[model samples]
Target: MLINIMGFLVSYVFCLIITPLISKLALKLNAVDIPDHRKVHVKPMPRLGGLGVYLAFIIGLIVIGFPIMSNIQVILGATLIVILGILDDIYILKPYQKLIIQFVAALVVVYGHVSVDFLYLPFIGTVDLSVSIIPITVLWIIGITNSINLIDGLDGLASGISFIIVFVFVILAIINQQDTILMLSFVLLGSILGFLYHNFFPARIFLGDSGSLFLGFMVSVISLMGLYKTVTVSSLFLPVIILGLPLMDTFLAIFRRLKKHQSVMAPDKEHLHHQLIKFGLSHRKAVLLMYMLSATFGIVAIIFSKAILWGTLLFSLLVIFISHYFYNYNFNKIIHFLNRKYNKT
Candidate 1:
């Protein structure tokens, strides 16, 4: 454990110290994201910032891995995410193309044998899944990857929220006697902290697709592995609930887009965080608020880990309520105005 902590600290500092120069190079190369009328930021910022983060995470894992969690699956799964995300970052791959790559990566994680064992009935006991966990796991992996990707619209938001989530998982891993998750927690913690140095408001860089997809996949895979032995079917819902903020936000964004007869994959600045930003908050403030919400849901999930089924439903409902209330209160007019003014664009 001590060794793992040391590894994390080293890797974290290396990535943190190194990201600024790397970002400068990306800027020189014109690998920058120019903020548009819809984007939250008001300047041109270099992306591909995940390069440093991915390198730092791998280095930390390679140097000091926990007994269980830091296996070849982490290596392979992370590699795929980084590779696919880099492709998207550079060339803007089509949705279908990225989906295929993500599916293949999801399969690799599945082969790692991190699976949902059984569905827990409310009054009844656990029912082992007869069908394949393939579809379920794939959807989870892809969904989470996109959730984090979209939330990256705000500075430090994705990485900070992820850091908190990983921190909670680290604590949970310790309590559950699962040392494997420690290595992952260590690397993720280190990478996010390092990345945050550049990602904070008045940002120097954006994580681009590379970092978002990479961390998202890691979070989903690690969380599943941690709970595989403990959760039943109803308990399975906890993962979704634990990630309620991102998942719910993604779902509603897609729902809103579909209702407007727009492409679900279209890039827009109306994500949950962005909506909050449009409602008179600064970029940093909105990100911080979401970070608080993310941490709140995370803590709630940990507090109710034992009441798997009930916890899942209740938390999910809570997420829906908050999102609906916020959207209705803060965003109905904005969406209508945007639709009238910019939907054609």
Candidate 2:
């Protein structure tokens, strides 16, 4: 407990101290985001803020005395992810280039023996993946990595959502008594909160591709370490629920693009956040609403973790119904009406 608190504080302070330096370096290196048609920010902002987050997390691990050898592969893969992000932030790498790097990094993590070998389905009992674990792990890492990046639409949006998700992971880790995962979750949550202080509305700096990609990679890895270790089918569903919003957004984006006969990687302004903005929510409100939605999913995951098989099924159905109804029936009108009512009051 003491060490976990120390890890969180060390990461928080490190990010607080390092982010300003990174901001200056980003400006000096001309690595800044310029406002464009698909962007929300009106001014050029320094990026590479992920450098601070990555450094702070590494330092926190060192401070916690975590075994270097045990995490060598994750560190190596994360290094590759950070490098890819830096290059993308600087030169705007093509989607294929970024995808190749992601695949290589995923391979390195898998090679380090972090593959999902089996699953415990509700009625079917244990199902072995055998060789199929390789592709499954790779696909999960890449999918999560891009899901996070795709949702980096608003200031503090990605980092804030990530912080919430990590917070839930921390709770789940405590419940499961996974010490290593608990420590990692604390450090990640602290680092993201530190970064969010500056990256929030009217942001001072951006996480760039580097921060988002690194965060996505770490989140996926941590979920595997903690949640995916369980034998129950609910274990498989936990991550999907915890990361529900971003995964849904990513899939919707791909489907939307496919229907339009466009490349799945093409940039656009039709994301969930954009749709909320179109529905009369301000930027901060939209982000806050998304945070609430993510937290709702997190709560569902927590309940599902403790539920029996029948209870899990019921909870899952409730979640799907509520989510669909919230979006389809009352999302815009309710929020807008509330805003108006509150303003008038």
Estimated TM-score per prediction? Answer: 0.87, 0.97
Give stretches of model 2 more than 4 Å off. 341-345
Q: Candidate 1, clashing residue pairs?
A: 69-180, 118-233, 119-233, 120-233, 120-234
Q: Least accurate stretch of 10 residues (summed lDDT) in model 2?
A: 335-344
- What is the TM-score (0 to 1) of candidate 2? 0.97
Clashes of each: 5, 0
Output the number of the lDDT-best candidate: 2
lDDT of 1 at 327: 59
lDDT of 2 by residue, 1-345 (tens): 899999999999999889999999999988899999999999999989898999999999899997768879998999899999998888899999999999999999999888777887888988898869899999999999999999999999999999999999999999989998898889888899889998999789999999999999988888877787788869768899999999999999999999999999999999999998887888998898899999988998888899999998888788779778876886678878966875688
Candidate 1 lDDT over 1-345, as tens digits, reads 797688779779988988988787777766778778778777787888887898888788667744435367657877988988877777778999988989988888788877655666666777776485888778878888888887888889888888988888887788787777777788779988988988888778889888899989888888777865664543655566578788978998999899999999988877888777666666666787788788888887676675556665686687679868875784657545544554356
